[model samples]
Target: LVQTWKDDSSIFAHDGRLNTPYSDHLLGSKYCIHAKGFEVNTARVGDSLYYGCVPVILADQYDLPFMDILNWRAFSVVVTASDIPNLKKILQEISPQEYSVLQANVLKVRRHFQWH
Candidate 1:
């Protein structure tokens, strides 16, 4: 994937050449990819919400925080790890109207993901 997006100007690929501030990237993007690391649990999801970026979580069998209280589907896009190859298609299939609702819900649920 790194090689595939290396020359793509649209992607921030983050190969050390993209030295912009992390907050800048988060705030500027509409959707943040929260791909799982070695551990299933990561701070990316919360971080995305904090910056008002809708999270595109690509983790299988991973439980998101506050699942019982928060309807994650309303604010974020949850895709299985197996669907990584089709990620672009999946995201594109989301209508603009649906994206707006998701983004609006991200703002509505932002307070819940914060420490304060």
Candidate 2:
């Protein structure tokens, strides 16, 4: 699957969902939150969480609720504006143990985020 954040413009003046291009674009890239401005909660976030691709969020604000219930710190890796290059390096060097833990963390949050 492939998905372009669709809102990564330099000026940052868009208001919409950043659908990761087609799923094919996501084949190996994992997941991303490359939207321009604010970041509350996005479908891509849920999709990546649900899909276990380890979301790479690019939003300035990671304002998510239920932090106590869901373990973003445990499962996913994040890169701030200055840390993108390091983030890429981390992606390339991720250990199997880390990957497995991330997957497990996703499952841990599954029941809480699932549709009723």
Clashes of each: 0, 13
Off by over 4 Å in 2: 1-36
Q: Residue 2 CA error for candidate 2 (Å)?
A: 12
Residue pairs with colliding backbones in model 1 are: none
Best by TM-score: 1
lDDT of 1 at 110: 85
Error of 2 at 12 (Å): 22
Name the lDDT value of residue 74 in candidate 2.
79
On residues 16-108, what C-alpha lDDT tens digit does candidate 1 reach at each position?
545677889999988888767764454667888889898888888767788899898999899897898887788889999999999999999
Candidate 1 accuracy as TM-score = 0.86
What lDDT does candidate 1 reach at residue 22?
A: 88
lDDT of 1 at 56: 88
Quote each prediction's TM-score: 0.86, 0.62
